[model samples]
Target: MSLKSFGAKIFAKNIRKKIDKWASKPEATQKKVFQELIDKAKDTKFGKDHDFKNIKSYADFSKKVPVRDYEELRFYVDKMVAGEEDVLWPGKPLYYAKTSGTTSGAKYIPLTKDSMPSHINAARNAILCYIAETGNAKFVDGKMIFLQGSPEMEEKNGVKLGRLSGIVAHYVPSYLQKNRMPSWETNCIDDWETKVDAIVEETRNENMSVISGIPSWVQMYFEKLQQKTGKKVGELFPNFDLFIYGGVNYEPYRSKFENLIGRKVDSIELYPASEGFFAFQDKQTEKGMLLQLDSGMFYEFIKADEFFDENPKRLTVGEVEMGVNYVMLVSSNAGLWAYNIGDTVQFTSTNPYRVMVSGRIKHFISAFGEHVIAKEVEEAMQEATAATKARISEFTVAPQITPKNEELPYHEWFIEFEKEPEDLAKFSKTLDESLQKQNSYYFDLIEGKILQPLKISRVPENGFQQYMKSIGKLGGQNKLPRLANDRKIAEVLEKIIKA
Candidate 1:
């Protein structure tokens, strides 16, 4: 091994030690973490308003602070953006991680010095843990290209505004920056297509051994590399061994990625968001990611099925159970108090607390009372693809509730394919059957003729990409919604297909 690889292995060993210590008594460690955050923020404006001084226990804290989504907390965030001091945190945040908004154009989530480590450290440890577990550290010695957003942040009210990946780009350690691919100039190109071309030109001959990014964008990068070199990704970078991905489920794209690489490589899944780095796959044997109990965030869970209830049950880490989906709520050092990040997750194991992302709380189809989530859809697609010997590039589903009065309500799937199946009809039918097997409510609706069999619309190769670019959300953490409560996204997709 090279000197750099040896050094990385040593570093990873140290991180593994810390992880073992934390995992040994997660409940106690998490309780102490919550107490520390409460003590630190008790003097801030938000703390004072919520009477945080006397909040002595989780029960007290939960009673004092109601769970709120981004829109409900916008009032305080606006003050922070307007240069207010101690409005939420102890002082002004270092930067704002902007994300997609519903009614508003965007949301600026605060990233303070205290909270920055949560994002940075968790990412570092994810790689370190993978290395420690697998004993594969040679990838660290060669160039590792991270396909991320522009690092050139915009200034708003004296705060830096950019995507979380962009912010992370600015903080890449000086030593590793030399081994990172694609110059900063190429990375700052705002247009994803132009930026990708620049990246291909710059790194086509570099010593790339590791790559990290969202799966869709990474696939684009690999396709570009293959076109340039006329070889598989593994042939282009013989030393390539690891891929780190997040922001979406990897199951649907796993086979496609393996085909592009021409072999299986080590893959690590992360559950990071603009709000915080929540979890990472720490063990090869475990199916779910181990939650970051020591990250400077206190976690809470609300049963997803009961989230619409007037008085839903809010559970803490100690109260969560295995195999139950819950909407995550967090109280972070970043000044978010009882904030609902809107993602749903289910605990696959609870002894050390491992979870898998289920879906978005608002992104589900229930027009005919056959509520189905992202996890179910993804699993069904995976099964259908396997059964039909097909390869899907991308897909999204929506409820077709506005059909003529004579037509029954049903789910419509818009799909893009890298490889078409031999029998498209079988693919659609298998997908419908898989979904019915996964969801009893959906099966009953079909049996009762309350809903028609699901319909599939084969989109042009770049249909989803065109739709995303048309909406000015071409890249950089922007993902196509897999499921919508209505036909809004599906309608736009239809227009793209027609055009």
Candidate 2:
């Protein structure tokens, strides 16, 4: 075997052993250690540098820092782009991870070296958690494929360096780093299309075992692989063991993947962002488990009701209650003080600190002005799927303005189904009813005629993925955004919205 392959095998073994240790610990012990890290972080440069002087205790820390939203960060991004740095941070930002948001335009988030380690460690633990949960560590013996953004970085210092992907390459355990795609650093700046195309061609014949990245890209690549090989991907990559993903919800996309592969693929959830890697999927379940990187930052939470108010209270890691929805705030190595990324979370357990991502603060539709939150939408979606006996592949929801100028607006749904339902129209109506029952304001809006009838677009095939690729957004950080709040967004929706 080549040295790279040999090294990967060794690295995989070492990671598995390390994961066993992390997963074997009792929940209480893990929480104790995590809390100690949080205490130390409060005193670290990254922590003290934040508005923590006012935070005498974890409770105080939570109370002092107001839960902020992405718009607040965008205000800072605009300033940095304009050469203002006072509120942005102290050091030079390494590069911005372009995130697709509600509006078509992307948000360029600053990611510095300080912010990098959080994601690196979080990704590492997410894998470890998977191993401990499944008790299968030998699956990573072959080449692993990561379908992420290209490795090319813009030219700097008379030399082009791949930015984030390059950083990932450099930071991956030295042993396993050799197995990464796109060897040459100079090819980093090529747009995702050219890069993905090249990656598809290069890995066509390689024996890949582990695949990682967003579900959409993986789905697209597997489709291409089928077209080229004229056989199931398992025939080509028999050793492929794990399919890890994060950055978006995995529901609706899971069944399609299982059917294509002819077997269920174990998936690991990762919680990473331009700012930090906050959590990972636990070993016990495919569902996301919060990996508390206590050493890197001090955490705070504000109840959902308390998120936007000026005088809202915040909760610390110690003070958080189980199953209550709270917006997250972080003071990390990158110097973001009391920064809220608009993520809502719920505690799965208090001892080990496992949490689940609830939803985005801004990603919701309130056509009836009932102010439907993302969690509510998710719950309604789950209920609708269960009741209608419809297996949705992928979906997005947005509020529409009817000519009636009604109080509650119409909700438009874009969906792809796994199979044709026996009662397609009835299924759609049931979905609408489920949404209203889940949220009475949704029903009130319908009764008042503020919102028009719910429209559904069961796409022909591969419709959503095509839409994503057209915008140069294929993997992680690209979810069909809810509540197209911007005026221009209405124009884009007009083209995609169909009954």
Best by TM-score: 1
- Model 2: what TM-score? 0.78
lDDT (Cα, tens digit) per residue for candidate 2, span 206-225: 87778887776677677777
Error of 1 at 157 (Å): 3.5
Q: Model 1 over residues 199-312: C-alpha lDDT tens digits?
A: 988888888888988898888888888988899998888999998999999899988888899999888999999899999999878899989999898999999999999989
Cα TM-score per model? 0.98, 0.78
Query: Worst ten-residue run, lDDT, model 1?
Result: 97-106
Q: What TM-score number comes out for model 1?
A: 0.98
lDDT (C-alpha, whole model) for all candidates: 0.89, 0.62
Local lDDT at 396 for model 1: 98
Where is model 2 poorest over a 10-residue stretch in terms of lDDT? 155-164
